[model samples]
Target chain A: MSDAMVLDGARAEGLATVREVPAPGLIALKGDLGAPALADAVRAVTGCAVPGLRRIEAAGAARAGWMAPDELLLVAPREAVPGALSTLEARLAAAHHLAADVSDMRAVFRLEGQGAREVLAKLAPVDLAPGAFEPGELRRTRLAQVPAAFWMEQGGFTLVCFRSVARYAFDLLAGAAAPGGEVGHFA
Target chain B: MLLLTCPHCGIDADETELSPGGEAHLTRHGPGATDEDVEAYLFLRDNPRGVHLERWRHANGCGKWFVAARCTVTLEVFGTYPAQTARPPQHVLDAIEAKRPGATRKLPVMEGAR
Candidate 1:
């Protein structure tokens, strides 16, 4: 298999990657995981303590935890992604946990900068703030009504959604972030 | 855009994840309580105050009903707890069994009913 791949989209610019992916702000990590290994995997990705993955705010990363018993998502920095997954899988395997390559099955995206919060508000109704969502904090919510996993980092937000709805979510975010759009109204 | 601090779901949920459940830790004045007590507990504090503790529901999220501590004085909510944990407190499983004898409904029936 090729190391990288890309899927073309309705918009000519489309998307490109060394690995086949869903869309922007989408990340997926699937494995033959149970709760413990999944927690270790998440810690590997976010570098945060995981005890039942409680709902508490993090110092720097906006994190939202979603687990399907074994499968999980650590939506954070794309830059930290490669190392994150490798480290996570390594940790899980070392502990004798089952894992699989879900990178192709999941899509990841990065949304950040000054207008990042505004962009998020258009899709989610939560008030994104330091107190509400400190860095490292994670939440599983809907993006434009689509179920998604979200994480907040230094100046941006990252998310992973179902592959099928990746395009719909992308279109919604793109439209929301467009100049003179609803998100623009908030700005 | 209010940040409802849920004890179970933690913070960081959109308003859509929760529904306003009115004030927090409120109690009835009881039978034959003073008129002043009733009024104060009933309709006296609708006005926003600083540091108010209110009740909220994690409707679409964890499905756990809990109390939210807010600052009506400041309009800031910083914490939450399970619904039965509010003030008056509901009887526990043991207490219910002892008092109502067969009060516990079957899980499947309750689930379907809800």
Candidate 2:
């Protein structure tokens, strides 16, 4: 099989740096996420605990975040996705849950630097105030008109949107990240 | 744009992240209900000019359904609550009462109904 490609090209020219992470392993897990068996199974596979509502937990390079009351998104290094998914599926076979690999179903991008939050505020409607959305927090919200996910890390923020609209999301981010596109003071 | 706080995720979601679910706290009419009752349940709705209650889903956020009490004309939101409950909570009712005195506490009855 041919090697999979990553959406890595971006044109960020301002304080914001927009670029794709390139082929991170993504797994969608749905079930009683609070259940002991499911939580243990997920921890076993990802080496992290199931995050609380709107929270993300990370161990090494793998991270798990709550998507809904019963759903979660597991992100790991690209090379480790397939193995991690199989291990989760096998471990949670008897549990009332679903574990599926969704690495290619969505594209992940990291938007950081000085005005990352400001650039994102132009599209997403949720409050990006430091106190409201701190580090380790994730939200399933919209970017402009498309459905997407947002999470904060050490230096910047990460955005995950459907692969179908990756271009639109990229362009929007690039435009917002341009020199004159500073949010609330655009010229 | 309207902004609603999702009871599930505690996020103040904008109208873009929310989907309107029509009127809230409607009685369900199933297989055993009378014909008129079923008709009222399905077709009848109270589009009051003030102090209206609505159902809204956080479509892009937590994906949980919630209820909101707001003014139809002024667009002032009283409060939001979880959808698992059959009716609006006491705090919401209190807020409405505080805003508009003598507002009807019960659901509006259909015309020509006993």
Candidate 3:
């Protein structure tokens, strides 16, 4: 058998730029948000404070965002993930929390350029308005019928959906981004 | 689509993010309880036409279970509260009373109950 591929080697086609961010480290941290030790362990690992509700905190190469009151998503460079998870686990061993590497379980896509937000708006039910979802904010919601997460980054958006339906997400984004799609207009 | 605010996350969760959990504050009737009591707990529901209390889960958001006081007819949401309490919070009751005067339905208080 051939080596497994991402997005099944499919490419995004549209006005908005859509491409997979290959192999980013995704670690899910879950615990009681009120625990100071959990916060400290997260800070020690990520070099940034654990973000508050619906917020993202980035320090140098590490980025951590709140997924829920008791859950957080930590992202780092692909190469740094293993060491970072080990350090985090060792530090947070005494605390009541769970840390798991979920890099391979999710597919990350970068949707950028002028029509990126519009493309997302077509699928997601949440408000994509600038004021509602500003930079560094994260939303765990449905993209069409699939569960996904969205966050604003680098003047664009980063979308993460389960790897099982990644091709479907890519197809939806590409179709929405195609020219003459009539998005953001009342028909 | 009903927009319910999650008391835990404070987000106005759209109906898609929320899952409706039937009636709220049901008295459990388990072993040693009378068959009538068990039947009431299992099958009986107020199904009131107006003011009602409901259980809802912020399934797609914070994943916390909460109680919502809403109008069955108009779909007007009075408020949401945490699910840990045995009864509706005072403020939630007050809001319902204020909105629909004399319309609040009280749960039957058992004699010698805590």
Candidate 4:
């Protein structure tokens, strides 16, 4: 019931401030690219357009992030997920598509500070140069042996990973953020 | 440290983010297949030291399967393409041919209908 379920008892004045946040209502949509039916279903449920490639699009109170060429992650208020899933499923029934609720299967984290990008750079192999990787871009890569996806929020980066690996993810983030471990890649 | 580009996601993915799916362009031998046919299909892979076409999935990034042509010896990736293709595209083949001339391993032609 606590937001720190995954990142419990973690404290340090590190490069970035890492904390576990409540997971958002997540619906994973998988279908053919450029499929109108699937797009309509997603837009109808999230009030947001399906993001292009690895971009994240925020609209109203909901948003969608591109997970893959054929997959999109819809983020919305947790309370609206059940009804949203039903609507999405009903609309996508005629198409060769898959729409499933992944809210409970995942965990969320936030990393703030100038070291945020550096925090992820240490864990992932992808380029985290502030210039190459700007806000609004979503990246899915291996985070210290676990798969994670991160996108920029207002203040910092918001990360999502499997709930089972939430504790490990938090530790990885915290360890990367530990003081004196800075690489200053973003500078 | 091998950076492989995922044709689907258009990102050069790290080898750690990928799962090797073994040899690429395999013709499956289903029911009524001989023991050799099954063995060749499943176990028998073209282990060429030079140009090798292999299957790789961007497991951590895009999660889409793709085919990669790289040298097993040099570890130089010739190119990568979407996994849906029945065989390596012309560009990938040309790249392999350009590097290791005549090193491309052509799938052995079966005598009859598989």
Candidate 5:
């Protein structure tokens, strides 16, 4: 994340705040994981149980989002990734799986404030109404033209897109968040 | 806008999020096959007017290929299943037949699948 970031202190002042945030560690677990054994390994690593489809589970600072049927994106601090990978590797040795460290491959941003929901609604196609997209739900969909995923976090959302398109994504978000008429659809 | 569920990820995906793969349930025309078989495999396709089985990839979402049973004229998608199936599942066929009688009548290209 430190190597290729174009937005280090980027932030937008509006009813919604779109600011670049330091990346927590990101790990991708993809495979045919058998129950109990693999589930235990995941819980042991992230402090959160394997989430159901399109859900994000959190325990303390660690989070695990179900990215696909066979994939879970785990989040930990930067220092904890190596240890987590080793633990997962040892437990899943006989199991067919891939545990990869992808902390640096992403550009993460936090969209918060009174206008946060409208900012997201402008960019993403998902329904962001209160009951429709509440806290703890994870959605992997496109942000404008780029592939992105965002999850509800209390009053706001934390979004992630590929590092290669961070600038473009930031521009899109900031532009939508610029001082303007309020959609208030989610408000 | 055609909406299809990704059978693998269990998400309702918009057509913009999906890449349409023309037809589904095609058998290969690999080695040891005659010219007619190869020609049919390479060129022939079922352009049925209704109750069609087609392939779709969830490009922006789960990134998995899925088969969709749909009505070509009405664009009413009956069901979606995984792409790993060599032929449309019985339930999907039944769903199609339920809406359009004799809808499972196979094309020449699909007969070998059964």
Candidate 6:
């Protein structure tokens, strides 16, 4: 199967990809088990071996880790996309813990440049100032009541939503993009 | 601006997730526990400082009932444990064990506990 799926609509075209690296902007790993083990699994997958911060400790320069107890999302380059999930689940399995693959549950996207933040403001309640969210900060919220994951960096903004809500959020976001600004996609 | 640690959902949920049962500890003066105990259970509170454990529903996501640890002072949350679990945290266990009449630990007793 193709590594990525493209979803086209009236206003926006969503590039749905099976990311290996958890996407540069936001990555989430959801589990049905306990938080600590799920968080540990995230650490194992992201290749950042740290200690003490259990279940959901922020890791990496961009602050990728478990945002919710049931899931962990990592923020990394688009190129790291393919192997990210397996590496995470495998490490957790070795520890005698179970980690469910939910990468498909969410759709990843990159919204950057000067116009991206303006587009996000229309949809999110939190301010998206570069200084405000920085790189590592992660937030769980609803984009039109659809569960979403978000992170900010110098490039602009990256967000992920459950596949079920991807199309809806994409239109909302794409519609909100600046008058002349373009929405770009990379998997 | 209070942060509630939901044991079941495993996140620092917004105050919206809780309905503010008002206070924590309660009196149980019935056949062994009374109406004054019942009245006090029905209404009244101490509103103590430090670590407070209270009942909260995961209204948005899980819809499961759970206990939460809340700090009255800083409004910061530590963590949460499942409500029906065989063993709750030692502190919560201690609070229920140390019940004294008219002690006034907190308010909004669990309706189901009656």
TM-score of chain B of 5: 0.89
Best by DockQ: 4
The predicted structure with the larger lDDT, 2 or 4, is: 4
DockQ of 3: 0.60
- Candidate 2, residues A1-187, lDDT tens digits: the string is 1123245555465758988666478888999886888888788878889898789999988899989888999988878877887787787878888888888888778898888888887778867766777788988998888899988887888888888888888888888788876555322
Tell me the DockQ of each model, to 2 decimals: 0.11, 0.69, 0.60, 0.86, 0.69, 0.12
TM-score of chain A of 4: 0.93
* Native contacts retained by candidate 4: 0.93
lDDT (10s digit) by residue, model 5, range B36-112: 99998899887988778889998888778999989899999889999998777788878877888876775433475
Cα error, residue B101 of model 5, in Å, equals 1.1
Q: Highest lDDT: give the candidate number.
A: 5
lDDT against true structure, model 1: 0.53
DockQ head-to-head 2 vs 3, winner: 2
- Residue-level lDDT of model 3, residues A1-187, one tens digit each, is 1122366445565757887767478889998877888888788778778888888888887888888878999988767778878887887788878888888888888898877877888887787876777888888878777888888878889888888988888888888888887565421
Model 2 CAPRI rating: medium
Residue runs of model 2 more than 4 Å from their true location after superposition: A1-8, A183-187, B32-35, B101-104, B108-114
TM-score against native, each model: 0.46, 0.88, 0.89, 0.93, 0.93, 0.51
Tens-place lDDT per residue, model 6, A1-187, is 2233225322342222112123243354445444455556555556453322122234455344544444455555445545665676665554544334455565666675555665665565445555655565555555555656666644655577766666677667766663654443210
Per-residue alpha-carbon lDDT of model 1 for A1-187, expressed as tens digits? Answer: 2222133432211111111233322234555444566566666566544423433333245232444323344445445556665776676665644433344455555665556666667777666655666555566666766676666654666666556666676676666566554444334
Better of 2 and 3 by TM-score: 3
Interface Cα RMSD in Å, per prediction: 4.0, 1.0, 1.3, 0.6, 1.0, 5.1
Better of 1 and 3 by TM-score: 3
**DockQ, structure candidate 4:** 0.86
Tell me the spans in candidate 4 whose CA falls farther than 4 Å from its real position: A3-12, B105-114
Candidate 3 per-residue lDDT over residues B19-103, each given as its tens digit:
8899988889999999999999999887888888889998777688998989999999988998887777888878988989866
Where is model 5 more than 4 Å wrong at Cα? A4-6, B107-114
TM-score of the second chain in each model? Answer: 0.53, 0.90, 0.90, 0.87, 0.89, 0.57
